[model samples]
Target: MPTSRPNILWISTHDINPHLGCYTGIWPGAEQASTPRLDALAADGLLFEQAFAAAPVCGPSRSAIITGCFPPAIGTMHMRTRATPPPEVRLLPEYFRAAGYWTGNTAFTDFQVDVPEPMYDELGDHTHWRLRDDPEQPFFMAFHSLITHESQIYLSDEEFAARTPDAQRVQKADVPPYHPDTEVYRTSWRRYLELISQMDHWVGTILDQLEEDGLADNTIVVFWSDHGLGMPRGKRWATELGFREPLIVRWPERIAPGSTYAEPVALMDLAPTMLAMCGLDVPGHMHGEVILGPDGRVQGRSEYVVSARDRMGEAEDTSRSIRDRRFRYTRHLHPDRSPMGHTEYPDNLWTWKELRRLFAQEAQQQLAFGEPPSILTDLQRSIVAASKRAPEELYDVRNDPHEEHNLAGLPGYADVQERLDSALDTWLAEVGDLGTRPERDLLARWRPDGRRPRAAEPEVDNRDGLVALTGTTDGSTIGWTTDPPTADRRRWQLYTAPFTPSAPIWVKTWRLGHEPSADVPIAAPAR
Candidate 1:
């Protein structure tokens, strides 16, 4: 390894919990035992057995990871609600960039946070790492994999069959008790496991490339998921399954191989941990503490980790949760609202659709007149009760790992509940959680127009054989796509410098919290 700063490779996958073979001890039967690459990676690194995300959803969770602060505290907790960070805030990559480290990130959904140009030397696909001008410079690269995303579960039957020829279908009896035991639910579970296997292959490819390039030993590879699975009572809930993540860190020169840490840690700590590992100071503004210090030794364990949830898609709600080694406590600010409220994203899931069908069928059975009553099964009734939760909940996680029983009002758990509630109150106050306020109020204060700020049109200048693209909007980043302006945001290229185009293309610009500019056609330069 180089005597100077070590190279950092951060790999993130979408929507998964610690459902690998290693975590089977914690979540028995959750593992499909199919991720050999990740299993091997775990054996060669330090595994964090109790890592959790600051939020259950992607945008808010990633915001916390990048900023080392709670998303709600930084005004970035809501999904698809983009905003520029406050002037006082400094992102993690910006600090690395200032420390002479080259920073880059592959395709990511920055739906809630705006990454300024100075924060990254490269922002595009995985090739950005190779495109760096100085190969010897210490680099911080983040690669995101979307194969395990929730949308993968929405694959058509033919697509699912085509992808999983050898995959084993999970039995309906293996489905968690929280969900109904049905073929639809079983199919969804099996499909998710199949995706996990496929994701492992993609992860293996990156690891193989690092080794083939002879950079594996010098690079500190960190692998983790953004949040939890995108199923009912997950992703948006403040439960253990929603926030817990699988984290593996490998640094052959520093960290001991095949070690495990059981301490409770939040994803926010990653930014500070990376800075500390690179022999840099943890910024005072960062809310997270360094879990791994400069000497590559374990720091003091976090007594508890806190997580929060706000608006998701169109449904608005607020929740805060605190989890210790033995217990998980959650407080829902809007207990009156059902968890089944219309959220467009999750509603697309086949399991969610099946649940909705059952809910509607049960509701129809309860006629107003003297009709013979058709009753819901115990599992269905439990689902309904969970949809409309109590204002406060307390779970003895050690005794009820699945978190099925609520101990908030239970007589023996009063003291436990009070202690956790106090801890949560202190955390909320310290972090300045804005989730306590209404979504509309926050929007009005931040964006009075009730819409994202608009960006100015991009100007294209053709000089000789080169094409230069500029945007009139200050602080906005320019991007171009061969496809239409409304093309997938992931397909657009982050514009940094002028280039000669092989063909005519469309250009657009966007700023955080702003609507993207209309696409402008750029004709190819004539000879």
Candidate 2:
């Protein structure tokens, strides 16, 4: 009998917002001439206007999407922090694999750890999809594109000038009010749109390939971004522009063409929705609800979406936000710290540098004139305020869509703030958010002694010029290094089979989520 399951293809992009032609009606000039392919995709698929990521940064947001749980709840909220989930906590792909689906992912896992062995039959570049053993078997695959990453904004001014001609450039008036209205800013926006156009072409190729392979009707195609645009006060902020994403889903078998869903949804919901569509049971541990099923209609209305911001690189801050239909409320745990506090990564961006340079120029002009030196635009003041956050922020998104005006302390909005605050509290409690605690406090909670859970010392056996290493932990893997244990140096080699030894070696053992065992030296065997 033919299988009833449909194939799944997830195409993810980096640091892009809902700037497509479909969303252009809402965000004017977002639709550049270069995005014909994406415009076509939106015309053919269901466009979700209110989809958001659980966190602003890539690693944490991806963790939430993959695991279907809030990153803070799983101790994976910090940027670049890799935490292996306990064996009991299965990932989204693992669930599908267990349900007899062939799963694969491109080289971009982006979760900051090894993809569990059971999660995918193949895990590599885009070509891995063609390497699946059985083409007829239902498959789930993810392909990630990096064309619109923040680093793309680093193009030289000459390059920007040469690449985007006047006719192709977005007008300076179209630049967001929060950003400076300068040639450099407009050039950056044009460059980003060009990259988006390039990304759309690649997406069209993949979709075309599916049709050529006769799998278009049997495949469910999803395209979205990890988070939002790679701009200052965008990528790392806990604002609408930071968390909102462009989500489009095309299932030829179920969904109607050109449908739009405005109810709030999140990247985390993708896992459960896919499972439900595949006729599998949703796991109890997942925090997201299924937003769509086999019927291809909106499953239910989601009233609110929660997002977070935490440590990024050397900078440290904590913020939580809740967005209901018309209002957005944010609470900053460390209101005293600057929102732009010394984050090296974002500081290097041309957008950010230009913003700072403009601010400095204005300040210097004021100082030269011997005035009070307080001549600053609302945008400039807002940027300054970002450095030092208010304890609470409430915005009527319908009226102040850019979130410029804070109404948390206003008289008439007390009830709105209180209601959202209560909802945020309930969510924090339910998710067990460790973001409320300091970094040291979180570390102490995870490990009472402030030390990692180390694996037991390995036993080394050497006989007849052969070396064999054994680990005491039941599921631990043995690794070896030729050098002694040092704070900065340790190259571990996974021990798979017995091998003849040429020199002395240090052996250790480790299991995921546990500290590696102390190094044990193994001497060379005598001839």
Candidate 3:
């Protein structure tokens, strides 16, 4: 039981859409997805019907979530890059910890270009609040269930067959119209839903532990996904399928059970909202708004939620989009680059392979018939489109949820296009898209030499019975351990404040996206 502050548990799943039973008919046939635990959880919680991620992929989406700033604003937009966030960007956990909350991550999931220091008091595959030294202390815990990640879908067909049960397997998969209907594609979809079911089980395990420990009533449990499904035209695109995701929160003390909030919200809004809920001042630099908090809902649809799809691995490109209730507007900055089909990572999935296969076969037939074929959809060929057809797009989501028809140049919609287009422009001007600058230029600035920079040596002094440590480099932090070498603590404990050790302690210095300093010993206060 917590004394004053409420505990926060963030449950994040990777690469999924709102495909649970609680989201009934959000996607046709999603009711059959079989997530009993999540369904029950939502039944007793608040379900957000229109939540969108800032990015379509994990690294960028998670970056925005942890930083409370759009990745583009902080130079962490591109996927899996080595860019460092500017110093003074306080992470959400740091604020909680400063307020005397014990933060823990059951396993690591930050794929942002920048990493936070003093990340967690405890971290491991099985780490839990139960393992904390003090049970009464309120805690911020995160559990990322990776069973639903796209990589799992890359398993061999035989492995999927062996792992799946007949009852749970997808039959006649409700294939998205953009994708071709084929046995191979259906199998891949089947495997994905099965994985979601497995992820639901993981959720049950964590929630069960919380209740088992008598912390259920006071803890706020939030379940969300990094992005939408990993299929083609989904994870790497800026369409609704790629950006919209599920967000459900169960706060027994604060929430009205079985209620739903349908206003649009950006996933990044979560960081600032969590801070406000904990009674901390939200940093002004954060781009997200306080949509929900202790006081009550900050009602109204977000004017527009901006999203981005930047370079993923070797396939480099950029696209920006903005979505309001009924319209989605997008601009592709680099259509000449290779299509998402050529992206190295997701290309391994059978769905991607199916797109390429179906597109090529249809192309051969088109050449023979001397006419364009309707069999291969623009959505499917978008995987391997020689280049994007238009630099901009507009979709009326309420009318065409799948975004099959592009309304950018169509007649009689100039007001809608101009309004959204202006809103997106204003947002970019205010925040400044760092992603527009060439990635190589950013790399050179961060690393003049071929190597990553190292944190300056840490200096420590024992003055007036209080030991203090400082770092020369900006954004640097210290990690120290009182334990000896025989104990493999794996990593050192984060040094947030000066403390009198029982004896001497070892310390190392680290700066985000830079090498850590060498370990050195510091003595305790004199008796």
TM-score of each: 0.83, 0.83, 0.93
Per-model clash counts, in order, read 0, 2, 0
Candidate 2 or 1, higher lDDT? 1
Model 3 Cα shift for residue 236 (angstroms): 1.4
Model 2: what TM-score? 0.83
Per-residue CA lDDT of model 3 for 11-80, tens digit only, reads 9999998888898855544676879888989888888877899999888898889879888888778877
Stretches of candidate 2 exceeding 4 Å from the true structure: 1-3, 84-87, 157-173, 366-368, 372-376, 444-527
Candidate that would win on TM-score: 3
Model 2 lDDT per residue over 1-527, tens place = 12478888999999988887778765435655457777787788899978899998899999888878887777778887666454345567766776677778887887744443335767778444577778777888898877778887677867655543432344432677667678777877877777777677788888888888888887889998988788877888888888888899988748889999877898988888898888889887777889988767779846988889999988888999998878889999989887667778778777888877776776777777765544446755566453566889999877877777889999999999999999999988887887666777766655677665666988877778688778786656566767666637454455666887678788777654567677788777675
RMSD of each: 6.5, 7.1, 2.4
Per-residue lDDT of candidate 1, residues 411-513 (tens digit): 8989999999999999888879787777678778667776666778888787886988787876566766676545564345556678997776877876655
Q: CA shift at 295, candidate 2, in angstroms?
A: 2.6
